[model samples]
Target: MAKMQRNTVLVVLSFFAIYFIWGSTYLWNKIAVTELPAFMLAGIRFVIAGSLIFIISKILGFSLKITKQQFKNTILAGFLFLTFGNGVVVWALKFVDSGFAALEVSAQPLVVLLMMRVFQGKKIQPMSIVGVILGITGIFLLVGQKEIIAQDGAILGMVLIFVCMLSWSYGSLFVGNADLPKNFFVNTGYQMLTSGISLLIISTLFGEQWISPIDWSIPVITSMLLLIIFGSIVTFTAFNYLLRIVSPEKVATSSYVNPIIAMILGWYFLNEDITAQSAIASVVLLTGVYFINTKKSLTIFSRFSGKRIPKDPVG
Candidate 1:
């Protein structure tokens, strides 16, 4: 009984960290950008974080041996995670605010659902289709206004951001499908190292200036450190820990929790200027997400609530 209770407590704590701390990362991203160029900052942050994890793994007696195929997949995963997923978010900040970027990026699960059908021939529920329609419609409204349309040239940035999200979705799918290393810690460390280095090399090619030394301030450095330490390491560690101890359904639910925190923090800290449209879109997005992810369960819930539920794994 005591062991069971302890396990439950750890699971709750893990969920809390994912829900709140991860949500706040968008605000952190906004602040960090004040001092660092997106890609350069990403490169430095992930590289250091990855190196620390790798070194720690070595000290902990983790095996570094990996099959050639595993190494190749890791690099591909790295590209998706750091390059497309994170890289797009970094670059988009120049054209769109971090809060919006966060909202936009939060739509990853939706993109994944659609992509699964197209790429893997997986079945998608009808509710999922409607939920996606509502979700995508909301996004289109957010980005298609006169003022917003003026930012259309930033459509390139938008496209990059979506591509990044798709990359993350695909990488996540691959991680679950691949021949993961004997030690997950070893695999994670290698992935992070690859991702970090990939960012550094790519950023350099794009001429992301590495030395913005003049712009560094206490807040900037602090935010960068937080991302490197807490966002990448602590939260990630907690997430993996949860996966080890719980059902994926229980662990996977964090996808729903992160965005609410992101939305609240974005408004509170970044002053991302949420309007009526944004608010409506957010509500609709949330509704769609709730229905989409819980469609099967909510079909049951609707019986209890005497109301219809919308659709799975929404943004």
Candidate 2:
């Protein structure tokens, strides 16, 4: 009974780590990019975080051995997820609000579902169709907001974030079938390092200028450290653990809750407004996510009707 209780506590904590910490990363990325270049910021973050994790994994006696196929897959996953997925997000933050970015990312599960169906001939549940409809409607509402539409480059920024979501979804789906290292920590560390190096190369190709003697101000340093320690290392560790222990549906709940937490934080700390439209959109989007995850197949069109789809592996 005691062991079961401990496991329950760990699961709950893991959920909190991914939900809140991952969501909060948007804010930190926004702050970090204010003084640093986009890809450079991401490169620094992943390199440092990956180095620390690599050291810790060695200390913990986890073997770092990886096969050639594993290395190739890891590089591909890293480019899709961290280099393009997260790196584009960081670049887009120059124009968009952190809360809005979080809300946009809340649509990732739907994106992943569609990608699987398109690329792998996977079937979607009827409820998933309903979910996709609602999710798209919510996105339209969010994107059509007058405040957002009025801003220069806001729509473009949004388009880039959606691309980020697509890249991440593709990486998530692809990595599941690829041969990765058995140790989650080691696997994640390799992905981060690969992504970091790739981003650095991209940054150079673009001729991104470095802010010599980085600001090192309190908020800048604090956000960078938080992202490295909590965002990359701790939250990712928790996320990997949850994938091993729980149903994917339960773990995917983070996609719903994370945006809410991010919105709250952005409002409280950065004073980013959460308008009525945004609030409504968030509710609609989360409702869609809930339907998708729960496998509630609402029959809409005869053409769209199908058996329930299996849960996807965690991205």
Candidate 3:
């Protein structure tokens, strides 16, 4: 009973960490990018975070032993997660407001549904397909409320960021399918180190030099460290572990939560304008999450394959 209670507490606390802290990353990117270039900041963040994870894991006696095949898989996963997913998100912060950026990335599960159908041969349910459509519509509506639209570089950046979210979704699915290490720390450390190195190389090729003009004061350093610790290590590592403990639907709830935090932080700190449109769109998006992540609804499509899902309201 005590062990169960302890686990329940841990899971609940982890959800708070991922939903709230990861939610605030958009704002963190906004703050960091004020004077520094986006890619450079991201490259540095990952390298530092990876180093910390690696060092700590070694201290904890975690060994990252992998066969040659797994090494190849790690590289592919790293490309998807680090190169495409995070790389573009950090760049997008250079263009869009963090709140709007968070809302845009919230469309990930819809992308994942389609990707699953394509790659994993997983059948998507009809109602869930409708949910995806509604979620996408909500995203478009949310974007309609955007205060500004940068045409050239900024618009391209937004497109890339959207693609980044898709890549992350696809990468996560692939990682789940792949033969992986049993130890989370070992696997996570390997991923961070390898991927961070790739990011460093990419940033260097793109001339992402560190800014001496940018504030490197104690507070700035502290903020960046918090992002590495809370945003990267805590939220992401906890999130990876959450799948073992809870329903994916419950895990998917963070999609809605991230944007809510982003918007509230915007209002509190950056003072971005928001409206009824955002509220309505956000609610509709979350309802879509409910339909998409519910396991029974997914099983109906998989078990029956072709027959229409029964109009059982319980599902």
Candidate 4:
């Protein structure tokens, strides 16, 4: 009974980390990217974070060894999810508000569903089909706003972000079946290290000017530290933990919460404008996500209200 209680506490804390910390990452990334080049910022952040993860894992007695196949798979996953998927979205932050970018990326479930249909010949459930349609409508409402589209490079940024979404969606499918390091912490560290190196290579190839950390402003430095520690290490660990201890549909509730947190933070801190149309789109998009995951039990609200989730087989 004591062990079960401790596990429940850890589960709740992990859920909080993924729900809140991951949501705040958009604001941190926006702040850091403002003063640093996109690739360099992301590369440095992940490299440091990955190194720290390895150190912590070693201290905790986790093995670092993996098979050759696992190494290759990790590299591929890293490039798809981090180097291109996340890096390009950071670049788009140069042209779009943090809140806007988060809202747009909130359509990821829709993209993943479509990709599964195309690549795996998976049948889309009736409810998920409705989600896809609402998702499409939400995206149209979001990107069609004249005020947003008229911004310089806004169109290009939105296009590239969509591409990044596709990359992330594909990466999710790949990782679902890929042989990776047995230890989730070690697996995540490998992905971060490989992707960080790839991002640095891309940065060098693009000839982006690298600014020294000494010259970075206080806000930028703070943001970078927050991102590396909380955003990458803490929240990602929590995410993996939740995936092990709970239903995936419950873990995925972060998708619904993150954008709302981001939008509020962006508005409060950066004074980002929240248009009426964008609010409507957020509702529509998240509603679509709800439908997509309705086939599975989602207990976000109950959990938030201090209700215990039914136990699942731990992975």
User: Who wins the TM-score comparison?
Assistant: 4
The candidate 2 region of ten consecutive residues with least summed lDDT is: 305-314
Q: Which pairs of residues clash in candidate 3, taking residues 3 or more apart in a chain or in different chains? A: none
Residue-pair clashes per prediction, in order, are 6, 2, 0, 0
Error of 1 at 47 (Å): 0.9
Tens-place lDDT per residue, model 4, 196-298, is 9989989999999999999999999999999898888888877766766776677877888888988999999999999999999999999998887673323
What's model 4's TM-score? 0.92
- Alpha-carbon shift of residue 128 in model 1 (angstroms): 2.1
> In model 1, how large is the Cα lDDT of residue 56?
81
Model 1 residue 246 CA deviation in Å: 3.1
TM-scores for every predicted model: 0.84, 0.90, 0.86, 0.92
Q: List the residue pairs that clash in candidate 1.
A: 84-164, 291-311, 292-311, 292-312, 293-312, 293-313
Ranked by lDDT from best down, the candidates are: 4, 2, 3, 1
Q: Residue 151 CA error for candidate 4 (Å)?
A: 0.6
**45-94: candidate 3 lDDT, tens digit per residue:** 77777788878888888886788777777777766777567767878777
| Shift in Å, residue 301, candidate 2 | 22
Model 3 weakest 10-residue run by lDDT? 306-315
lDDT of 2 by residue, 1-315 (tens): 011233888888888898888888888888778888998888888989889989999999999889999999889878888888888889988888888998888887788778767887877888898888899989888898998878898988899999888887787666666687877799889998999899889999999996653656678789889989998889888876776676556666787877888888889988988999999999998888777667342221111312111111111
For every candidate in turn, the CA RMSD to the true structure comes to 6.1, 4.9, 6.1, 5.6
Candidate 2 or 1, higher TM-score? 2
Better TM-score candidate (2, 3): 2
Order of candidate numbers by TM-score, starting with the best: 4, 2, 3, 1
What's the lDDT for residue 197 in model 4?
91
